[model samples]
Target: MYPTDFIERINSLKKELETKTPLRIEDEKRLKKKLRLEFNYNSNHLEGNTLTYGQTELLLLHDKSTGDVKLSDIEEMKAHDVALSQIEEMARENERPLTESFICELNKLILVRPFWKEATDFNGNTTRKKIEIGKYKSTPNSVRLRNGEIHEYASVEATPAMMTDLIDWYRENEPSMHPVQLAALFHYKFVCIHPFDDGNGRVSRLIMNYILLKNNYPPIIIKSADKENYLTSLQKADTGKQLAIIEYVEQQAIWSLELSLKAANGEDLEEKGDIDKEIELLKREKLSKTTNFKSKNTVYDLINHLHDDLWNSISLQLLKFKDFYEKANNEIILNHELDQKLSLTIRDNFNLFKILAPAIKIAIKDNHLDSTDNFYDIKNLLWIWSYSSNKTATKDIEETIEMNLQLEFKFYEISLVNNKYELERNGSLISTTIIYQSKNDYDTRITSESINNILKSISKQLIKQIKEEE
Candidate 1:
C-alpha cells in the first residue's frame, strides 16, 4: 500500500513536470500542499501495515484486562508521534529553493537535533554517556554498533575554525564534482569529522537528500532494512577501500530520478535509459566535459548540462516570440509591441544566464565531461525559470533582464558575505556591500565612486551583523 502511494505520487510529479511554463507563487503553494498530502498518506499507510496482531489484541484487551499493557503502548505511540512531528516540523522549516549554503545549514540542524538523547546501545546505555559503554572490552568507543559489542565512545569536539574550513572547502570544490559524487564525498567527510557526538549517520543521510532535493531531485530514504549494507558502504568509503559510497549514491540518485520521472508522467513506473552508459557516451562525445572541467568532472558535467538546457529553453522562448510576430495577420503595432516585450524578456534571461555561468563553470572545473545526458527536458527548464521569475514579468523585457542579472549579483553578494564571516571566525576580518541610490531631479548625476562607497558601507554593515550574530 505504501509503495502504491509512492508510485502514485511519482506519477503525479511526472505530469507536473510537463508544464514548462514558469512557476508562479500559486504553483509553488500547490506543489507544497500536494507533497504534504502524499507524505502523510504514505506515512499513515506504513504505520497501519506495521501494526502487529498482538498490538491489535492488546488494544482490545485493554478494554477487558486489568494490565497496564494498553497504557504502555499508548505512551510509546505518543513518543513516536512526537519524534516524527519534530522531524516533520524541521523538514518544513528548512524547505526553500535549493542553495549550497542552505543545504549545509540543514545538515548541521539534522546533526544537532535532540533525538540523539533517545538513541540507546545494546547494554541500554544511551548515547548521552560520556565514558565508553564497556571499558573492560576491546571494542572501540563509538555511537555505532561494531560486531556484537557495544563500545563506550568519547565525542570529538570541533572548533569553529574546523567547521569554517569544511564549508570553505565545500564551496571551493563542490561546483567541480558530480552532484552525486560531491554529495557522497560530503557525506563521508562529514561523518568522518564526526562533528557531533552522535546521530552522524542520520544527519549525513539527511544532508545527502537535501542536496538532491535542492537540485530538483527526489529524496532517498535509506530504509532501516538496508542498515547493514548502508553501514558497510560507509565503512568502505571511510577506509578508502573502494568507491562503494559513490556507487551507492549514484544508485540512489538513479532511483530518485526514475521516481521523479514516473511521477511527472502520471505512470506507475517505467524503464530508464542506462545512466552510466549515457554518461560514458557523453564523455566520448566530449559533451559532458565543460571548458573548466579539471578535478570534479562528473559534477561539472551535470551542472553544465543543466545550464545549457536552461539556456536552450530560453532560446526557444525567443524563437516562439519571433514566430508570433512573423505569423501575425493583423494588429501590426500590437504585434510589434509584444515582440519588443518578449525581446526584453529574452535579454533579461540572457543576463541571468550570464550571472549563473560562473557558478556552472566553477562546478565543472574538477570533472571533465565524458558524456552528456539530457537530465533536464525543455519543459523542466521552463518550469525552473517560471518558478524563479515568481510569475511577474518585468515592465520591459530589458528590465526583466536587468532583474535577473541583479539576482545573480545578489547571490554572489551573499556568498561573499558568508565567506567573510567564515574567515572572520579564523581571526580575519573583511567587509563589502552594494547599494543603489536615486535622486528625484531630472538631470541628476550619479558617479561610480558613489556607488563604490555605498557598496563598501553595505559590506561593512553586513560584516557587523554577522559579528553580532556570533
Candidate 2:
C-alpha cells in the first residue's frame, strides 16, 4: 500500500494530465509517440532486448533499421508496439471489464507464435520449452536469488486458482484504491504468480500501464538501465516491504507526467538523439523511394506463388480428413482460368495457366488493383469435397456431406473457408512468399509458417463442421 503522500503525488499528476484534456493534435502526437517509445524500449531492454534506443526508434517509428540486429529482437519490439496500441484501445473501453481470456490474449500478443526457449527448473535441470502462446505454464518456474536460494512461484496445480484470486482481488479493490497503488500492487502480485512461461515481466508491465492509462495517467517506463534497482524494489517487496516497489514506480510515473505536461504546453519534446534517428531514417527512405519495375512481378507470378502455397496447404491438410469419412474425394477447383468458369483441375495446366494468367491480370487491373504496380488483385481456390458420413462401413452410406471451401489470397493476407457453413478467418502470415516484388527480391515460394496457420485454421473448421453434421 502507498502512503497518503505517494497517492497524493500520483493523483496530482493525473489531475495535471487531465487539464490537457483533449490535447492539441501535434501535442498529442508528440506525447503519445514518446510514451510509446519509452515504454517499449525500457520494458524490453529490462528483459534484455539488445536494440538500442536508436534502433528501437528506427524500427518502431520509421519501419527501417540500419544495421544487423537479431530478428527476434525486431519482431518482439514490433509485437510490443502492436500490443501497446491494443492495450491503449482496451483501456478506453470502461464498459468492458477485464477478463482472464484478455490476459491470455495479451500474453499471446507480447509473445508471438513459433517461439522456443531454454527453461531451467528449480533443481538446476534445463529443458527446451516451446512457448504455448496464450496458455499458462504447464511446468514449474522459479528464480535464483543471492545466497543461492531458490525463489519458487505458484505451482502448476495452484496457478489457475491463484490467477482467479488475483483477478478477483483487483476487481474488488479497483474502485477503492489509488490507481498508482493498485497498478503497482497488481504488478507485484502477477510477478509472484508468474502465470506464463515467458514474457510475464512484459505482460505485467503492460497490464500495469493499462490500469494507469485507463485511469488517465501517462504510463511509466522502468528504465532498462535501472533493471537492478527495479528488481531490487521488487526484491524488497517480496520480503514484505511493499512500499519500495510502489515508490519506485511512482518515481517513474512522475517522469512520464512531467514529459506529458511539457507536451501539453506545446514545448519541444525531442530528447538529445531524436534528430539523429530522424536523419538516419530519412537517409534510408530516400534510397528506397521508388520501386524498380520487375516484369516477373506480374499477376501471373502472384497467382503461381499463391497456387502452390494454397494447393500444398489444402492437399496436405485436407487429406488427413479422409480417414474421418468412409468415402472422401476432393476436387481442388483452382479456377484461375481465362473465362470465369469452374473447372476442377487435378493439377495446374501450364499451357492454360499461361493463357489464363494475362486475362486474370487484365480483369483485376480493370477492377481492383493497378496494372502498373503489377498488383492484379488476387487469386482464389474453389475446392469441393464429397464425403460419406461414417468412417467405418457399419451400414449403407446413408448420408453424404459435400463441402466447398473457397480460398482467396490478396497481397499479404489470406481468407479461407467461406462456404457450406459459416467459418472464416484471415491470416497475416505473408513474409515474402505471395508478393514477388521486393526491395530485395525475396525467394518466390511459400513459407512453412504460412502453410501452418492456414492448415490449423482450415483443419479446425473442417473438424468442427464434420462433427456438427455427424
Candidate 3:
C-alpha cells in the first residue's frame, strides 16, 4: 500500500463498497449523469479537444451549443458521451471479464464516424491516411519526443498479439492485484501499445475507468488543468519511472471517491474542492501583486460621475448601447447604478478587491479573451472595479478613498504552433492606466465611443499581429 492519505481513503472506500446498500435512485441517476459528463469532458480535453465546460454541459444536458467551436469537436463530444453511457450501462448490468472485442467496440463507439487524417509517417513525411474506426492500426504508429526522436510502438503485425497478451495478463492478475493497480498498469500498457491509429489515449482512459467501474469503484478523471503533469507522468512511465503517473491517477481516483461518497449521502456537489479551489488559489496569488494607486478622488465619487455622464452620452446612442444591463465582449460597458453600489463596497472593504480581480481574470481567461486566437465576442462586459484603502486617509471620509481604478486591457498572442496552443510575445500588449480626476487627463471622461474605439484599435493590431505570426 502506498504511504499516502489517498491509500487510506481507498481502504475506507473498500469498506463503503462492502455496504452493498445500493445508491438511492435519484442519487444513482444524478451521480451517473454528472460523472459521465465530467469524464467525457476532461478526457477529451486532455487530447486537445476545444469544447469548453459550458459548451459541453449545454450540449450534453440541453442539446444546446454556444461559441464558435468546430463541428468535429462537437460531434466527438457527443460521441464520447454516448460511449460513457454505454460503459456505465455495462458496469450496471454486471458485465465482467472485459475482452479485446469489448474494448474495440468502445473504440468504435468513441470515434463513431471516423474520417481521414493527414499525418506524418514514421519517417517524418506527411501523408493522407484513413483512420479505421473501431479497428487496430493498419500502419506503424509512433510519437516524436521533444528531442526530435521517434519512440516507435509495436509493429502493426505485432499489435494484435501484444494486445492479446495484455488481456491475458490482465485476466491472470485480476485476482491478486488491487483494482487501482490493475487499472493503472493496464492504462500504461495500453498507451504503450498505441493500439488504434487514432483515439488511443481516449480509449486507454476509457478502459481504465471500465476496470474501476466493474470493481464497484467510481471513475477517475484526468482534468485538463493538469495536462502538463499528466503528460509528464506518462513520459516518465515510458522510462520505467511509473510512480509519478501511479500517484497522479490515484489522487484523481481519491477525488472521484470523495465526490461519490458525498453524492450518495445527498450532499451538494459544490462542496467538493476542485474547480472552485483552483479559482480561489489563483485569485489569492495573482491579486497579491496588484499595485495600489493613491488619489484624492473616491472610487464612489469617480464612478458616480462617470456613470451619469455615460448614462446620458450621445455616444451611447451612436454605439447602440442599451439602457440596462446587457452582455458585451472585449468592449467594456459601465453601469452607474451597479457601479455605485460595487464601488461603495470596495471603498469600505479594500481587501474585497482581491476577490474581484480573480473573478475578472478567470472570466477573461476562460472566455479566451486574453488569447487573440481564441477571443470570444463578449457582447456585454460591465466595468470591473478594483480598489484599496489608504492608511493616510482619515478614518471615515468618503473623499479620502485610495481606490486604484483602471480599465485594464491585456492582450496575448497565441499561435497554433505544431497543432498546439503556443504563447508568443510578438504582438502581446499590456495596458494599465489608472483613472484619476486630474483636469488635464482627458482620458478620465470614459465614454462608450472612447471604449469602443479603444477596442477597435487593440483588436486591429491584435488581428494584424496574429496574421503575421501565422
By TM-score, who's the top model here?
2
Model 1: per-residue Cα lDDT over 70-159, one tens digit each: 222333233333333344444455444333344344433332222112345557665433322111112233544566644333233332
In lDDT terms, which candidate is top?
A: 2
Q: What does candidate 2's lDDT look like per residue over 1-470, in tens digits?
A: 45744667767877887877789998999888888988999999988888777778878877765433454576789899999888899999998777889889989988877455778755567656767878999888888887688899899899999999999999999999888888999999999999998889999999999999898888888988778899899999989998988888888888888888899899988777778866755655564333322232533453444444444345545567666655444344433324333344322322222223234334444544344433422234343443444554333232212222222332232334324421121322211112111222211234446557766766776666556553
What TM-score does each of the candidates earn? 0.35, 0.62, 0.56
The 0-to-1 C-alpha lDDT of every candidate, in the order given, reads 0.37, 0.67, 0.60
Using TM-score as the measure, what is the rank order of every candidate, best first? 2, 3, 1
Candidate 2 lDDT = 0.67
Better of 1 and 2 by TM-score: 2
Relative to the true structure, candidate 2 reaches a TM of: 0.62
Model 2: number of clashes? 0
- Write down the worst ten-residue block by lDDT for model 1: 328-337
The order by descending lDDT is: 2, 3, 1
Q: What is the C-alpha RMSD of each candidate to the true structure, in Å?
A: 28.4, 13.2, 19.9
- Give lDDT tens digits, candidate 3, residues 1-470: 33544667786876885574487888877777778777988899988788777567667876654333454576789889888877777777664667899889988988865556778865678776879998999988888777787889888999999999999999999888778877888899999999899999999998899888888889999988888888888899989987667777888888888788777788777635547644643543344234111122222223343433322121222223221112211212322222321111222233332233234445444544454322222212244321112123222111111122342222111111001111143323222322222231211334334534544543343334334432
lDDT of 3 at 470: 25
